[model samples]
Target chain A: MTDVEPLAVTPALEAHALSLVREGSRVLDDVSFTVAPGEIYALLGGNGAGKSTTLLTFLGFLSPSGGSVQVNGREVGADVAAARGAIAYLPEAATLYGHLDAYENLAYFLDLAGRRVDRAALEAALDQVALPPEARGRRMQTYSKGMRQKTAIALALLRDTPILLLDEPTSGLDPVAIDEFHAMVKALAAAGRTVLMVTHDVYGACQVADRVGLLRGGRLVGSFEAGPQGRIDTETVHAAFAARGAS
Target chain B: MSLVFRIAREEWRLWSRSRVVVIAALTIAVLVGVTSLLTARGVADQAANRTARQAEAEAAFFAQPDRHPHRMVHYGHYAFRTPPPLAVFDPGVDAVTGQSIFLEGHRQNTAMFADARSGADLGGFAALTPASLYQLLVPLLLIVLGHGIVLRERESGTLAVHLAQGQSGLTLMLGKALALAGVGGLLLLPVAALALAAIAGGEAPLAAVLLVGGYALYLAVWALFVLAVSLWLDRRSVALGMLVFAWLVTSLVVPRIAIDAASAAVEAPGKIESDLAMLSRQRAIGDGHNAADPAFEALRKQVLDQYGKQDVAQLPINWRGVVADYSEKKLTALMNEIAEDRMTREAAQSRVVTAFGIVSPALALGAASRALAGTDLATHHRFLRESEVLRYDFVQALNNLHARALTYADDAARSSDPEAEARTRVSAKAWSLLASFRFVPDPASARAARAVQPLGLLVFWLAVLCCAVVVGARRLRP
Candidate 1:
């Protein structure tokens, strides 16, 4: 049951009027979005802003009250296994199996996704993630935040899925690890993979994301598109974020 | 399948490092070895002692001086039933049932000197046999080892990673189940080795195989049950609580309730009532010793008419011997009817216990284990039945001796004349003609056949729990 092979030529991600209610409160209200191939879409929001809910709905972890979430162009929750197969997710905590070493955890998770890997492949993934060879055989309990994140991204690379979802991937990372993560994120986008990073780090989003959107009160209040622009207009970005709804 | 094994391999490595798991496996292994050795030795001692006692009783009976046939009938014989070679693994109902029985003419006796009559602690706290260890403690160990397979994953957030990687809930549950079953199999290796040794030493091979297979099936069931609860529950403590509760209800509470329910469902008449029924039937057949009684007087006239004799002196066969033979035949038939009725009621009671196997596989395992070991109630019933048949045969042989060896003129005057008394006494060789009571245990095929129903019930439980685990696993989310 764990082995879900992908359908060829599926889109990265798509959502249509996704409405969600939790505990009798409208969390995500008719929110619709898409992440194109080779694009990094940063979703920004305040607390109680339905940012996590939208991510969960997209992953098929939460059933939408009204509307649909699609990953790899397949309807979410309709065929959750297939949908999950088309995407790689890196949680905020990036908790790997504590009892298992990095290499064992990688092989197990990859095998679960129906991917066969040899020792060389496993070593390559760890090397790509910049995890020290010594750490590959050590228990994950001894790992730092940056190392786990690297391993997670390395797993996502092994997954080879076109879409990646990062839930505050840099939340607890140090400044140097954050820079390293941003570089990895930019590299993944450059390699033509769609990445949707759900975060509250406004400055980090402006720095790395091809486009940034402010989500508040169950809606995408504003969209700020940017290129390798001169400099981010912090005042203007803040003003747009401060606007509540229907602007 | 490969992915499931991969997951299992990882868990096994973890278990190896887990002090709690290693300690538990070692403890259960020790218990199994100790219990098997002690129980086997105890049962062997019991069989040897019973055989020796039976031999002595047979010698005493055959050594009796020449005596009148009727007097010899009252002396009776004792029959001792030996435990089957596989009794060490299960002991079954042997501890609670008496191994020796006293057989006599015109009367049937229940097997006495049962261990239960003395105390329940004969083998310590519920007769701690190998079967009990498999039924009670192994499941407890399984629960301790695996009740957190899924919950720990969910709590530590590995389940999210797995799910995000496209791993279905069913696959995860099955992998955990396989891992738990592997541990159980490892722990049970000693008992399996002992069973094979028993088979090599002349125990029924089929029965031993079934014993091993049945215990494996029983343990698999617990593994699936653990996975079912682990998937359904969110908290490790809660899952462990529910699994332990299930163990208690199925293994301990249900067996006792099954017995009480069976006794209530079937009304087996007590010994006193059955005795009264046999006595009434005896009275109806008339007294053989009283010639003045109307029933005997009518019989005497009929015999006289048949022989065309106006008196006892005219008949060629001794009329007293004829009366004894006639009374013995009628009384044996009446006693058989009572015995058959009692056996039927007991069968009905045991059936009730078997029917309860649907909700409780523990009871089913016990029943199958007993059946394979040849120590169940069915085996006990055979012992009693065979003893009665032998008793009737020997008694009838003696009655025939009385009719043929004694002349009517000499037999009737035996009490009045010393010469008649010496002539009426039969040769001592007549006692040797009777065979000793030999219990023929049913073949392994028959016992294994009887165990099929309970084994099927165990399979059904595993199948159902497996389904539950799959269903519960499918819904796993972060």
Candidate 2:
């Protein structure tokens, strides 16, 4: 073990051997990772790979069967609101109140995240995510999947949390929206925020992530560092994921 | 607009395509229909029994052996307010408010034998009528059908696709609410038709239309509320559990608890207390022509003074007539006061219950529907008041005959001699002069004043639910 004290320095997000058990089965087995400031880590997995479970557990929505999750070097589960306050989570296809307009949707989440954004700031956040001006006042019931996804991004931006956890963030976006989302993720990391994303798209993950980790059967099977100058092909990642799947 | 209709149609198609949903809808329709029919039948049977009993009581009163007017007052008549034709749709408080009242001279009787609260263990499980079906069961069905509208989309991974296509959660929730409202309208069709049938038959007024409108809006409120819950909870199972608990609390628990609290808050004087009070007051007032009392002596002296004669026999006006008039006025005052007090207590209880309508729309609708049906506490009070007035007139008419038709010497001698008493008894023709009791309900114009507060509360609930939908939509992330 490294002699470095886990608590001495504050990382954006750090999970030291976090484990979660459900119904006598270990869904997340001894997962350990450190997402330092300005780092983007993509969690790559197939079905039942414990990607969603790990994010949820880190949000303090689920208690770990064993191990600890920390955000800004502060322990999670012990202080749920404080831990949640530091992180913003975007579930796959985030469900919004359909009766409210986009602006109201953002406002509600901002309030929930213990931050208040004035209308101008709220509008700026929406604009940053590439949501149209006209869509702000229209009820979210009229919004498309891409527009809703943009609103979700706007919500997270309004929170201004140090860490972001996203599950299948680009799953249903159109090409343009997906590109805009990738650029937004890059910008967030550039701002010294840590991002932990779960994705199945190898190319998309390679484009946005600083390092990629493959998970199989509740365990992180492989970790690859994508250096700034180094190029990694999708075929190599697919082979590694398949080999782990076979094991 | 056509897109909305198309979406609504799609929802209908989707709902019908699910065998479970279709079966549930069918079951609700059948239950509402059967409940309507049974309640209507029950109302009709009750009306028939009341009418037959009323006619029998009248015949028996007229068929009696000739007796003194005071003795006839003690032999009271029974009058029952026949249930209205629309009461079949919503019995309202008919079961809680007694239907039959014993009307007699100098005494006010409580309306009795009409409480539905007693012995209602298992009877409450089976639907009593369409009112029960709409008030308790239909909203529950709507919740079951609509609670998964958004949650299922999210659960099955289709919600993201829908959102990606430019649809928002607000639009989805609204679409589902509109669709459920349509289903609610469908469920209401049979009952609306029944209410219309009553109006066309001349048994119900145009106010029945207002009843249908109120019920429709009330059910819509429930539909919107259910959709709101679905939007709020992340998991479909959690949404389902929460919605069911809400339905149970609103429909079953809250109203029962309110009823108990209201009853405890306002205690109504029992029938025995009222009877004894009337008896004591009557004795204190003095029985007219009974020479053993100070009140009779004062009455005799007043008659003589009014006629400017030294004795009752010497007065131009029949002294017996004067005595009968004086006695009845006193008794009438006492009975009226007692009746008024009882009515005041009952009204207080009803007001307390009505105040709870703000929390539960079911109570508001139930109260309003019953008021429109003319079967609530107010209507019961009206019937009793009218009966008392008629009883006074009937008794007084007989008293007038006893004074004018019979001589004073014969009237006084009847108490001592059986031969003179037989001679003193008024003829059957005199009995026919007394008017039959008739209950005339106030016109439609009058009912609005009584129903407006509850109707306003129902509207308030609808507005609150509309706000909830907006707030809920705003809370959705993406």
State which candidate has the highest DockQ: 1
The CA lDDT at B153 in model 1 is 87
* Candidate closest to the true structure, highest TM-score: 1
TM-score of each: 0.88, 0.67
What is candidate 1's lDDT per residue for B1-478, written digit by digit as tens? 9878988887898888888988998898899889988988898888889878888988898899988887888898887887777777877767876778777777888842222322211112277887788878999998998998888888887788888888777777768887998887886786688678778767888888888899899999888888788888879999988988988898777777877787678877777788887787789898766544566777788889998999877788888778877788888888888888877877777777877889888888877887887877788888888888888888888888887788877888889998998899998889986786668678999999889998999999988987888778777787
Question: For candidate 2, lDDT tens digit of each residue in A12-81?
Answer: 7777888889899899898888788778988899888998887877766568888898878778867755
RMSD of 1: 5.5
Q: Which parts of model 2 are misplaced by more than 4 Å? A: A1-247, B59-71, B74-76, B96-98, B112-127, B288-291, B313-321, B415-419
After TM-score superposition, the amount by which residue A6's alpha carbon in candidate 1 deviates from its true location, in angstroms, is: 28
lDDT of 2 by residue, B1-478 (tens): 4434544555676687677898988999889888787877787788888889989998998888767766676787886776666777866656655577887765666643213431121112244778778888898789878888778766755454333322344665676777988999998898788888778756646568777887897898888888777777799899889988888887777777766877788876667777887787788888765544677887777667777889777766556766776788787888788878877877787777777888878878777777776666777778878888877887787777767777777777877988888877766655665576667555655665677888899899888888888887644542
